[model samples]
Target: MTTKERHKVLVLLGPTAVGKTRLSLELAAAYNAEIISGDSMQVYRGMDIGTAKITPAEMMGIPHHLIDIHDPQDPYSAAEFQEQGSRLIEEISSRGKLPFIVGGTGLYIESLCYGFQFSEAVADEAFRKEQDQFAEEHGALALHARLEAVDPVSAAKLHPNDRRRIIRALEIHHQTNTTLSASHAAQKKESPYDLCLIGLTMDRKILYKRIEDRIDSMLADGLVAEVKGLLENGYSRSLVSMQGLGYKEIAAYLAGELTLEEAVILLKRDTRRFAKRQLSWFRHMKEIEWIDVEGEQNFSENFSKIRAIIAGKFLSGLEYTSEQYN
Candidate 1:
């Protein structure tokens, strides 16, 4: 289908601490758009600090969706994100607004962008049970190592604590004798929307410093207390929600598996690794117009470049009434 025939969707995505939130808010205001959060953890209520969730005051009256709609224990998947995001795209477009998605979750964002076919991985009960038994015997990390041996691509995207998906990816390999990533690559990535896919990047040194600073801020904002409260409320540490970045490390510290200092060190290290993996995933994705934001002191110059890219892609013929960049 032609570009004019497809629905328009704007996505702002990148690794953590690359300034996606600030840019997304600006772009949304400029284009009269509603945002759908693409982060997996931000969908859960009470995960604000760790997820760096955008606050009401920060939203600047922009309508945002798919955030705080799920309790910590409720399961969410890429398939679900695609369904809801597609519906929201149509609804927002019908209301004469653009639909924008913003976050660092590569799989969730890419699934929505390309309408990825996920049904190719057939279920294998016996294989899944065997892997589960192995994980129980060895550990989630060991099981993840097994996956890394076969499907390194999928392994890079999944966290070691995410046993379910790791097991599923392993099962796909076992049942079909093909790596899960290969299966995904085999799909015809035909997008249903006229997509403006923008990616933010920065020098690794600067990005790492920003990540460490952000983690420190989250700790100061009571990320440890938040995890403790959830645990006190009888939430299982084994729950997928509890296994997210800050929650997992803090839970470990609280459980006496690690000291506060040790947990902080581990969290910072893991987060850096996660950011690297996020970039690796997005680099493999197609059609992203990358903007290097390093050395742009106040991000004013970077914002202008991004805005111009958006305007050229989606607002070519129309006059724009954009908010002043703060």
Candidate 2:
């Protein structure tokens, strides 16, 4: 493959409610690009509303891949996502179309962009059960604290409230007898793609408002009914998909653990926190061309700026450095 063919990827990424999907559709329309979703939740079927999946009508005849490819009960991981996403990227490029990856799943996007490697550690069901029981008995924070003692770097990077990752880190340490940070450091590999990463961001106040409005819209669009449907369909609360921001909060409301009003408020708060985490993850990556959406410009203007950047770097055969944009 030529240089352009090898590293020709366009990623539109930002926090939820930051207009990434809308702007990405416009860019795809302009370039006749194929979109491969980078969202984790969007891969599961029947998760449309909570995941904010773009409908077929909303796609406007633009082809999309990697959405609704699995059932919600199935487990999907970043490693699987990277493999599938890379395959889609190649397939789209083979058809002479630009492969545009768009979503708020920072880890999923980063795995593709940086080619992060997952260890060959198989899931030990017994071990996982033991850890779960320990967590239940000793609290999630205590388990995270144990991880902190062994893998301070990973612990420092992960939030204490991130029970999933904390447990995974501990599991890795227990199974491999090595810290996750060490394994992660040892597997620092270069990416196979030359990515033209476009990151959309807005003022914090504006972003918070948008997040609030989006939660309201989701509620108005029957988010509660959606979660209720999932539960009624034999889905478990412990399932990872059900633990997503809107799903879990609304599930609580349905279960009578929280009032509808309280659930909505909590959902908004959690979504904002999730967005902040997404921004933090993206900020740590140095390769992105950050576009401030609140810079007195509309989406079209901001997108034009992005298009010019991508064209200059990838299509125009100009070796533009990141410093030029900074």
Candidate 3:
């Protein structure tokens, strides 16, 4: 590969519990790759079990970046993920190493993949304070309705409960004199690398089953205890990381807002819904190579299929030794 032709990056994206971790490790090992996480929640430190972060033992000695890189109180956005992830991709590719972006955070992945132009609009505290005051007095729905009036496109994409993003959309419009939706639309397709977008899927029943099983595994791995520890460490339930699938439910349980049984049920249901949303997001993205993962095919077999596709597309001449994946 020549200087310009060598900048190839692989993206392995799918919904939660789709077996992305194992395959990512195998592919990273086989291709002399470094893993750059595409997960949004996994960036928070001390958010291990609930996030289902790739544990050190599971990483198989491959270097991974962007996991556990942020505090739970810190506000990490897709724009931040884009800036940091783009840098990692360039550095990894320049060193003749493949950068494998793996996880289910669709917004972060897509923004970085398409080279979305992130506005340098910083948070306007006074404007945000006014927005918050309005929300406090008028309620979240009322605040969201106000957003709908000014930037209907952004309002349509953001949920009423997402006060932060709603305020942000309003903030951007107030500070930049431009609508958030218009800025997004104005972004050009200026990706700097050749991308191989590999999507993983399975039968709906199997995928839902996997989601349930993964939730159970997370609880078994002490997700409740993890939540308690975070709260004890002064992390508030209002923090963005605390609102993630497992953490939110468990936090509610710990606060006596719900019984343990109810929390578990809610977590499972929410995770399934999240998985569906992830699929919906990916469906809207262009140029993805979808591969249906069979339920019966174990790791080695699945690895064979994925390896073949990736080799044909990105690493045409890179010879992978058998021991590499072992």
The root-mean-square deviation over C-alpha atoms between each candidate and the true structure, in angstroms, is 1.9, 4.2, 2.8
Query: Which candidate tops TM-score?
Result: 1
Candidates' C-alpha lDDT: 0.88, 0.82, 0.85
TM-score against truth, every candidate:
0.94, 0.90, 0.89
Looking at model 3, residue 55 earns an lDDT score of 86
List runs of model 3 lying over 4 Å from the truth. Answer: 1-6, 134-161, 175-178, 296-298, 323-326
Give the C-alpha miss distance for residue 188 in model 3, angstroms.
1.9
**lDDT of residue 241 for candidate 2:** 79
The runs of at least 3 residues in candidate 1 whose Cα sits more than 4 Å from the true structure, single-residue gaps closed, are 120-129, 317-319, 323-326
Q: lDDT tens digits, residues 223-274, model 1?
A: 9899999999888987888889999999999999999999999999999999
Instruction: Report the number of clashing residue pairs per model.
Output: 0, 1, 0
User: Which candidate achieves the best lDDT against the true structure?
Assistant: 1
Better-scoring candidate (lDDT), 1 or 3: 1
